[model samples]
Target: MSAAAPPVSSRLFSLFCLASYLLSLSYGSTFLLSLLIGSRGGNELDAGSVISAAMLSTFAAVIVSGHLSDLLGAARSIALFSLLLVVASLGFALTPGFGNLLLFFGLMLGLGWGVFYTLGPIIVASLVTPAQRAKYFALLSGSMMTGIGSGPLLGRAASALGYPVTAAFYLAALASLIGALLFWRLDVQLKKTPSASASVARISWHATARVLSSRAVFPIIMVGLGGCVFGGLSSFQTSYAASRSLDYSLFFFGFMGAAISSRMLIAGFVVKRDPLRASCLLSGLMMVSILMFGFVVDDGFSYVLAAMMLGVGYGLTYSVINGLAANEAPSGTTSQSLLLFSLSYFVGVFGFPLLAGRIIVEHGMVTLLLTVLTIALLNWLITVGRLIWRHVSRIKTLQQA
Candidate 1:
């Protein structure tokens, strides 16, 4: 026996694993519908805008939702949010007439994701030990990737079945329903735990304000910036696929699948090692990956490269930052810290792709790719510089002491 591998919370790992599976299923089902819409008549700019609008919804709602979690607690918030997601996804499929795709999708998506973005991490935190976060997060990533990696293939399936974009919406709703069910169960389990049952006074917004202004905030923000850049450019992956004359839905497979798998393996290892150093290394890789996207003249070859690079960046770097943000969160500040971390990252998701959309429409794909390269490189440099500064400062302090 391997000393029984020590005691572990099955509930915590199970919840993360289950949630990951459901969310990926939801991602796969909905993403294909969105792509189908783009294929029908939506231009790259339009498609990009629509997707960004949905992300914008989550971005906008993250803070308030998180703050709410601190008051009502993670389990309740998660339950409420996951329910909303299920309803919204189902209702969106039924919403027939479309005019301003951006406005409608954005509002609905924001509402749905706001709930998810706000509570998912808080729930995970409640379930696991602080030290176990990286490993758990990796497990979550892997589960999600295993499901999400198959998202594009959902499109292939939809296309084969001749399901229109509208029909795909119904399928997405089904996936969301499954995910919501898992979340509901997870919330119930969380509430049953002795740890979660203890009463703590609700966190006031005034104190919340102070927590966000601390030293750790800087590191969190820096990590968030890098995340945002990576996320924002990714918002255009579907559009980029369309531009290449390849199947837009299929393109997601290459990137997301690789990303999901990479994180599954890397998150735990780096978290246990030096999370910050892992972040720096991954940041360099991300910059190289983004820059590599710029030189792809051949559509097929470039996608393969792009997918591998993205997977590596996401697996190694994305995991590092996520782990660090959670690991470094201060007392009574986990909700706020995770939410803020999410907020900055989404700002990238909302802003970066919109910029890319404009670039794709006005400047062209090559220009857009180059622009992504520039932004990613800038983020990489700033992040790297900060890590070096932090390391040197720590060494000097020790020497002086």
Candidate 2:
């Protein structure tokens, strides 16, 4: 019933295509980091450091960007940050050495990444009404998941083409360029057309804090618990996929291909129905997918299937919870609550995966997978517990009334 729920036209729909592409590039550029390093004579440790650097940067700055989305329009901020990403991609692809690599990939690249994520969800909320957010968010999630799911295959193609890192970086940069342009165009459109529903108030920090502290916090926590499994996959998918002897960028890309396809196809429909329930369902899928992947040895079909399932799980869940936060967020509190949500998710992404990697070292692959499954199971339990609590509380209130 919010005024934001006006009928969307085809042109409005075009905005999603751009979102998908930009997210795809963001993921793609990061996916091929290992190949970039390997091509330049770096070793596994070096590659690990670079990847960590980016994640570190992303986790550290998400809040700042989220807060800043108020001063800077989400669309404009994303566009400008993406421009930085383009430069960083070029820097990593064209430059040399561990220090310079860290400089661009760690700092510039991370900050650019910070911008994309910060603005992305806010803009997503802006595009849809509170009630509609789950469905639209799912669509955007699918687009991003589908695009990035194509990562390993695209990485392989780059490697095969003789300049693996360069090729992938170029494609990612191109995709991002289009995304930036589309975002800019969206900004322009907003300025010129002027929706009958005037814009909501700028995002508010005080409002954001309360939303972050709401009843919805439980679901966000549950998702974070479940997200540990995906975090592991994102970190090691490329390096793990490639030959120990040869840097096969295709390994991770192939895995991404399967994951993205499933997301793009099913995510929108899933969210449209009931985003919260869809996320709950995805928690189950996460258990199955992580369990299946525990057995994957090298870059193979099992790994692909596992990746696909993880993609499904993530695609199914992320935006649902995000939509919930956006919906429950007060009139002017979009960015902060979402920032809190991102912080929770990224913490899992950056920290747990590192733990998993250590598990990979100590416990072996199958055991490591079991760890992931355990994490998923933890999430499932969290969801059930919270739902039960809500149900019981409602029943008690009804009895009292």
Best by TM-score: 1
Please give, for residues 1-401, the per-residue lDDT of candidate 2 as tens digits.
35655555557656755565565665555656555666677644455456555667776567567445556556677777777777776676677665654554556666676667655665666655666667666666656665665544566676567855566676777777887888877776654433322333333566656776775576568657755766666656555544333343333444455445555676557666654456678777877777666554344555656666666666666766777766665555665666666666656654565566566556655666677778788887766776677789999999999
> Across residues 184-300, which tens digit of lDDT does each residue of candidate 1 receive?
666556666654423222345664575566655654666556645655455566666666676654446666666765665655566777766676677777777666666652477
Q: Give the TM-score of candidate 1.
A: 0.84
Q: How high is the lDDT of residue 390 in model 2? A: 70
Q: State the RMSD for candidate 2.
A: 3.7
State the local distance difference test value for candidate 1: 0.60
Candidate 2 TM-score versus the reference = 0.83
Candidate 2 residue runs with Cα over 4 Å from true position: 35-45, 59-61, 66-72, 97-100, 193-205, 242-269, 272-276, 296-300, 330-332, 350-367, 398-401
RMSD of each: 4.0, 3.7
The deviation in Å at residue 99 for candidate 1 is 1.3
TM-score of each: 0.84, 0.83
